[model samples]
Target: MKLKLAAAMLAASLPLASMAFAQGTAPADLAMIDACLKTAEKTGGFGGACVGLVADPCIKAAKGANDDVAKWKACAARELAIWTQKTSEALKKVQAGGFTDVIQAVNDSQKTFAASRDRFCAVFDKIEPGMYPGDASYCRLRETANHSLSLIKLGAAVNEH
Candidate 1:
């Protein structure tokens, strides 16, 4: 009877777990981003700012470029580089202390995240047709920044465990 109850409970929770995972960005993450933006606005520094904080200036620059494709591309490149470097460093930190399974999971998740980012950003191409590079770059920057932040937090959690 105990075993049956356990199995039933597990089955019931599966959908809830799936829903959380399917949402991609949880409410907590959105809250964090909002808090970070507020803090960044108040402080004008990256000290306690969230992952997107690093890309904030680049985004601003892109917007200020007045639709100049070259300028927008430049800002996008900078933002991408920042995201890539930070994510790589965080992943390495996690890998250094994680077990084999943990390391493998992190590796697999990063790849999956990258693929998802690309596909998600591709939608922006159609949103503003003919703005190919700029629109796509903006989407990539936002996605990469958010992913980098999540990876950093994940690394901290892994280290804690």
Candidate 2:
């Protein structure tokens, strides 16, 4: 529960994405996802240039600090907010594609993914006391980003046909 408590405290104290930007920690703008997606659309994938566009810089900035793990988690949480937003937009696009069954399945899958992530992170906190919050936040960020990308790809492919 330490990770949960830490995350909650951090969330309450920080408006994550904005804090990351105001601190000059995350070089990429929060709106930069749009450009990444546009590049993905042309390149058929989010290449290295776009991958971790926000997180990489944020994490790098936090490196070597005494509370590096905590800083990394905070950085991940910041980018996670943007990815969460991107997930919503991508979900909407996929839903608008008019594949009722596919949409329903994706909805169910998303719910399950959230539940699973919460459960896994909670247990992970107990198992790895030293790495609780940072690891948890990184897990969340990775999953959210992957789900967002998946939905975007699905939307494009579905609409193509």
* Highest TM-score model number: 2
User: Could you tell me every candidate's TM-score relative to the true structure?
Assistant: 0.57, 0.71
Query: Total clashing residue pairs per candidate?
Result: 0, 0
| Number of the predicted model whose lDDT against the real structure is largest | 2
User: For each candidate, what is the lDDT?
Assistant: 0.54, 0.62
lDDT of 2 by residue, 42-134 (tens): 877753355466766777777653547767777677777776656666676777788888877876676466656656655554555344445
lDDT of 1 by residue, 1-161 (tens): 32233223322322322232234433444465557645754675432356544344545565643556556545454445554445556676677665678777766665456557667877876765335545666567667666666666666667875
Query: Global CA lDDT of candidate 1, please?
Result: 0.54
> In candidate 1, where is summed lDDT lowest over 10 consecutive residues?
9-18
**What pairs collide in candidate 2?**
none
True-structure lDDT of candidate 2: 0.62
Q: Give RMSD to native, each candidate.
A: 14.2, 7.5
